[model samples]
Target chain A: MPKQVDHEERRAAIVSALWKLAGERGLDRVSLRDTAREAGMSLGQLQHYFATRDDMLVFAMDFISKRTTERVTARVLALDERTPEAILRMCVAEMLPLDDRKRQGSRMSISFYVEALDNERLLSHAREGSRKLLDFFEQQLREAQDRDEIPADRDPRREGMIIMSVVDGLTSYCHLGLHTAEEALAMAMRHLDTLFGAAHETKR
Target chain B: MPKQVDHEERRAAIVSALWKLAGERGLDRVSLRDTAREAGMSLGQLQHYFATRDDMLVFAMDFISKRTTERVTARVLALDERTPEAILRMCVAEMLPLDDRKRQGSRMSISFYVEALDNERLLSHAREGSRKLLDFFEQQLREAQDRDEIPADRDPRREGMIIMSVVDGLTSYCHLGLHTAEEALAMAMRHLDTLFGAAHETKR
Candidate 1:
């Protein structure tokens, strides 16, 4: 048998190219032709795979959502002990625009988020992705409370919400350019340390 | 003396129209002719208000920045007391998107921020607006600490940064319909109370 190309890998390649195209031009400006060209395929071939622009967009968004979740689980699975620090390190790493792929992914996510402002179906996809991120943070908060890393009296959900908000906030700041990707990540890590380390245990 | 139409008021009216149009269709999609038409003026009249499309974009962006600052300051100044709870209440209220005008204004600001990514002059203006907002939070953090609203040991800069981040993240959620604006606001407010209440000396 001749060597076989993987269908899943090929689909991912298309999504990868689509993400790059959307990042350079805003999502509204990216077209099937542009993505096909970027992916080194004909329009016919691209359409054969995606069938429609909405299909392509959904695939691309889900592709990103899956990859991100994979990275976080991989990090957690590798941790020796899931301390607040260990969990936070992994979770915060997921938020950083650490490299070109992640940066483009972030830009695409941002544009999609704005577009979702006008489209509920799209917003549902966005919301699921958001819930996953927040869930991971809340789980960590609960784990920390169990381990007595934080005070038992402190509400995990409320604390988790604060951490999640800051993560989301710093992510936008990187795109908005209040800080570089590296700078924002570092600043956030510092901020997280304060809340999780000293302050949480102290009662009012 | 014959009443002269204040250039300032006319300029504000023109910018207001642009902001409204941006909310309706986004910044990139809004055109000079359409904006002028929406503002109930001819192209020549709009030109007298702003000479070119580029001028209008720059002015519109600058107007957004100034208005946001003014809104924050207006609320802060009007507050009768500088108590930590009072200040937190005032600042958080200004930061939230509880009404249509504030929501539209914020959406318009984000639109300008995206446009500013490619435009250097507008980038500085946008950055300055962001920095000023962060500074406002920082000042509030300091004030809160002095008044025993928050822990004195907490780093004001980092706390401010995180709070700003939380505010931005909630706005992203609101924009994407992840949560109702009121629900998101309530969630955020509850967490913020924990953050402040934990650090303070007051016991309930």
Candidate 2:
């Protein structure tokens, strides 16, 4: 159990190194040798955890995606008012690149997104993650509808997809510096306000 | 004059080759040598047109952006009813990867977008294009508001940005095959419906 814990720690360190390199330079510029140097390990040691560049990328993406889910879940659980509408807003906010750490996460996700466009393994991995998020959003929308917070006629699945797209688009613009993170979050709030009915003001 | 024309043609041919390679293998995998070979030319010939990989990428991006603008313009002009709603829908449809050629274009753009996250020159180039597009969208929205087609209280610039973001998010999803082109277009139309008011049914 101790050795297993050590292995996990080392892998986490390498992935952290990968993120550092990817954040400063785009993900495409990352190489195993450079990552190993950044992690203060030999290439051979890095290879023990990741056999190839793709292997390293896939592992890094999984790590970040899981971490993001955990972070978002924790934030939602700690919220004072966890109405369906509030929960959805919290999730959307978490998805946006609102600060430095979140921005780096967004950058890494965007890189993987582009890579996923052509790589089957990465594409499936991304799709699975997206599917899970969409299902969760749909569930929240359904809950809102049940509580009469949103129109009953609205399709939860479609609404969830639109919310996802808006958040994604805002994230892209934020990364490009075309819109500030604050501006993006405001836009997302506006969209949610329209969806949840103008009468339901956010308690936050 | 013929020599100048030939020079332009050769550059076009090279860019075309780059697109083909990029569309199939992703842009990050493309190299000057590979592009030259794909174009049925030599490395020297390719280097003559593009001194560096960045030079090639910038040129190719410019070429593609110009072509996309011209095509979208043509489609908009051909529309029978050029209302703000109609025009915006047409532009959004053109932006989506609804077919083979467009899918390839989106793939290339996505790759460039990732690159632009780190490269200043490319970032500026991308921002310039996005600014122009946003301005165009805002103008259309302003006209709509003036005509009382959309609510006058809505901010034209902000609405334009939201439209752009929704379309962009949909485009990314479409490329990933998470949503078919048709599904993305439907989702975009729904957003427009909500924006333009429920009474304004799309002519198309």
Candidate 3:
């Protein structure tokens, strides 16, 4: 059991190194040899954990997605005001690159997304993640509707997708420096205002 | 003058070949040599048109941007109903990957976007294009407001940015097949409905 725990720790360390390199240079530029060097390990040792570069890439992507979900869940649980509006805001905010850690994560994710466009395996994985996120968004919107927080006529599924797109679009622009993180957040809040009605504005 | 025209044509041909390869494989996987082969030319011949790979990339990006603009312009010009709402609809529609040719273009553009994130020169070029597009969107919203098409209090600049983000987000999902092109179009139209008021829905 102790040996297995050490093995997991080493893999985690290697994935961390991969993210660091991927963040600095785009993911496409990352090589197993370079990642080995970044992780302060021999190439053979790194290969022991990940048989192929694709394996490493897949593992790294999976790791990031899980970590992001855990972080968002923890944040949501700690919120004093857990209204549907508050939950939706927190979820969207978590999606954006508001801080240094998130910015790096965003960069790596975008890089992975581009790579996935051409790779079927990666693309399928991405689609699965997207579906789950979309479902979660829809659930939140449905809850808001139940509480009469939003209009009865609103289609929760479509509205969830639109919110997803908005956050994604804002995140991309934020990375390019076309819009500041604060500006993106304001735009998202305004969108929520339109959805939940301006009269129910949540206090900061 | 004839020699200059031939030179320009050769460069255009190379860019076309690059796009074909980029559409098949991601842009990161494209190489000058492979592009030359794809163009049915020697590497030497290709090098005569482009001094370096970066030079070729910049030229290809610039060419795509100009071509897309020309296509969108031609499309809008052909519109019989030239209201601000109609124009906005057309513009957003053009951004979507509703067909094969556009799917290819979107794939290339996205690949270039990921590459640009790590390349300073490419990022600056991308930023310039984004700024211009955002400005155009703002101008359209302002025109809509002037005609009393949308609410008077709507901030054109912010609305423009939001619209930009929505379109971008939808485009990305369309490529990933998370949303069908038609569904994406409907979502965008719904967004327009909110902005222009449902009563003012333009007759298709």
Candidate 4:
């Protein structure tokens, strides 16, 4: 029997190398040839996986988001039966760049954001990803309100926007060295507590 | 007598053309040759003002920041004898991309931010500008506390950080079309009111 190659694994390896190069230099330095060199693969092999540079970038961003979602899922599962506030706090904290890996992810995200400003395909992917994250947070906030874990008067949509804004903002600041990862997480936690904890306390 | 060339005006024109090109295409597309073409100047003439690509980018970013500071100063001056909260609210709202001009400024900022990730000289300029903005907010917050305009127990540093984070976050969201500029300004205003207005009201 002929040996079968793991295409998914190969692509993942390419993305990993792409991120390393992007982090060391800047996202501006990423190119199909350079990515192939970094991945130790021939340009033909990289082209076999990613048709174009934008395709590779889109895949890289998707891969990062998927990895983040997996980590978030595991954290949520570990906190089984926890309050909505607890789950949200965990989710938001995990979304922050709390480690080297996540910081690199955040840098990649900034590149995506800046590129999306002028690239339609990348812009659509970014918008879709942002919309999904916003929707997930909105659903959680709505459920929290329903359970009275958060105040009933809270607007899930608005709060969702706020949560997303805070995460993005803090991550950027953390990347800039204005704040440490620990401080960013702590500040996010405090913001959440003020939003969820204060309302519940006042109601009680 | 030779015609007096306005060197400052010439540089401003180059920076304006830079922003226009950067806005239409991604920042990566910006080059000395392209910028010269877009600005309708010979490459040699462009080199007279900007020796390198980095030099041009640094100059463009500084020009944007100086323009913003000028607007902030004008707004503050217009609100003569206003409360700290009023001045701050105005400043925060003004900092957001509420119109075409400000949005272009924000786009340029995002460009600088991404480039700064790898370029040390640009990164230092970005850091210095960020520090100055943060310091300005901290000073305003401290003055507010001293004047009893806000709660005495408020932490100026923390509040300043929160305000900056919120402004930066909202601006990014606005750029992404996640929220309208009006909504972004409203959210930021509400956040500021919560921090300064509510506490002082209760005290009274």
Candidate 5:
């Protein structure tokens, strides 16, 4: 029997190459040929995976969403007690670009986001991804309120929206060199501390 | 002498055309020919004002910074009382894309910021603008502290950065359709309220 690998794994490898290229150069400079070259695959092979630039872009954007979900899921699973503030902090931190890999991921996301502002298909894809993330945040906030981890009087949905905004805002600031990843993370954590009450205080 | 006007005014008109184009389409779609057509000027005339695409981009970015400063200046001038919270609220609100005109300005700024991740000249231009805005926020915070408008224990520079982050976050959310302009403004105001204490309480 021939050695076999999942087609999804192979496709992800190609997408990874494209993601790296996107970080090094702007997304505008990417082409099928360049992507093929970066991926160490033949042009014909890349063509089999993505028929057009838009196809690759859509796939890349989707891949980014999946990557983020996976990271958040892993973080949530690893938390020991699953306290509301702990879980929230872990989830928000994962959303931020706190390292080189995350930073590159964020840059690609922003590239697609700006592109989506003009492209309808990309816009829909971007919106779907955003909604999914917002849903996750809202759900977590609701859980915290249910557990009495935070004040029940606070509206989870509104607070969820604010948390999401702070993440995106810090991401933008980091990209512009206004804040380092560490500083962005610290600022975000401070916002959380103030919102949920300090971590230790909430834990008690 | 032939009829003459300030060269700066002519350049500003050209920049305005580019700004409109950027809003209608993403910055990636802009080109010299397209900009010339949009401005109703010959390529030669546009060239006389801006020698290269990069030159035009830099000038356009500078124009954006100047326009924002002018708007903030006008708002400050019109204020009846320049208390720290009042001034800070005005500044943060102005930074947010709370209406169509401001939204377009923000969209253009984000487009340039993404481009700047790959382009150094644009990065420098963006950095300068961000620094100016941060300086304005910090100065207002300090002034507020001096007047006892807020607690003196708070670090003005750090608080200034946090406020800036919230503004960018809300702006991104507004663009993504997660939050309406009014909602974004309200959320920002709420954050300010929390940061400075409730309106009357902070006044005391």
Candidate 6:
């Protein structure tokens, strides 16, 4: 009997291929034929899982969302001796395209965001991903407050919104295809320092 | 002979119809074809001015951007007696769906943002809109510092990012099709209150 394929890994492989394809061009240009070719799989096999373009897109959106959520989970678990400011800086820094994997991920996600606007089926997934990310930020901000890295009276909800907005704005620097990743990070760091500096924090 | 159509009025009519369609559905769903029909003009007439679909979208995007800039300018010009805190609040409030016009404008813009992500063609228009909005916020924050509505040492860039993010978050309330306008505005107001209250600004 043929060895049973690992379903999770197979799904991940397909998504990675699709995301890479979408990133290289625009999501509008991605097709089942291209995805299958990129994955080195039979068209029959690709269709067996996704069956249609919408199905593939929905799955790919979910895949990226899951991967990002895992990153947030890892950060939460790793919070140790570092200050909230340090941890936040590091966590946000990771979202930047400082390396190939991150750059690809950011590019794919940015492209997906554009597609999500017009496509009814994709919009919900995109919106949900944003909500989850914001919730994670809220949780992290609360942790920082609890750790005495932020003021007790500082509203976690508002702070989280502010942090997320700054992240969105920073992405525009790259989205413009103008600044180097390092340059964007530096600009972001300077702004973050002004907003989240030690001077602004109070011990619990 | 039919009264010669006012050149500017015809273009404004098309743009007005385009925004109305965008608010009712979205940017993607409403095509130039739909726009022509809505404006009671022939497809040829629509093509006469825009020349292509891209041209139409660019015009629509600029239409929104121009109107917003004008409103902000008018508001700034009108501020004679209110404190800086009052001014910032008023400016920020305009971005919220506190009324029908703002809500419609936001929903339409959210729809366009998806396109702006990767369309290098579309990205600059979005960036221009954001820079104008942010510059206004930054200017206000600086003025507030001068007037002591916000902390004197507060960095304008960071403050502007925070404000912009809050506006983006509020966009989710409507664009997500999840929260009613009232609920979203309430949540936004709560967050805004927490943010400004934390600063503990001095009276004018």
Which candidate leads in DockQ?
A: 3
Rank order by lDDT, top first? 3, 2, 4, 5, 1, 6
Fold similarity of candidate 6's chain A to the true chain A, as a TM-score: 0.81
lDDT of 6 at A20: 74
Question: In model 3, where do residues sit more than 4 Å from their true spots?
Answer: A1-5, A198-204, B1-5, B42-44, B198-204
What DockQ results do all the predictions give, each relative to the true complex? 0.64, 0.71, 0.80, 0.55, 0.64, 0.26
Off by over 4 Å in 5: A1-5, A40-47, A198-204, B146-153, B198-204
TM-score of chain A of each: 0.83, 0.91, 0.91, 0.93, 0.88, 0.81
lDDT of 1 by residue, B1-204 (tens): 998878888778888788878777778788888888988889898899778777888887777667766876787778787665666666776777889888887788777767776677777776777787788778877887887778777777777787787777777777766566787678667656766877653674
Q: Which 10 residues in a row give candidate 2 chain B its minimum summed lDDT?
A: B195-204
Which residue pairs does candidate 2 place in steric collision? none
Worst 10 residues of 1 chain B by lDDT: B195-204
Off by over 4 Å in 1: A1-5, A198-204, B1-6
The first chain of model 3 has a TM-score of: 0.91
lDDT of candidate 2 over A76-166, digit per residue (tens): 8999999998999999989898888898888889988887776888888888888888899999999998887887767898889989988
**B33-115 per-residue lDDT for model 2 (tens digits):** 99999999989988998998889999998999999889988988999999998999999999988998888788788888887
iRMS, model 4 (angstroms): 1.4
Q: Give the lowest summed-lDDT range of ten residues in model 5 chain A.
A: A195-204
Error of 6 at A171 (Å): 2.3
Which residue pairs in model 4 clash with each other? none
TM-scores for all candidates: the values are 0.88, 0.90, 0.92, 0.90, 0.89, 0.78
List where candidate 4 sits over 4 angstroms from the true fold. A147-153, A200-204, B147-153, B200-204
lDDT of 6 at B130: 73
Measured on C-alpha atoms, candidate 2 has an lDDT of 0.86
Backbone clashes in model 5, listed as residue pairs: none
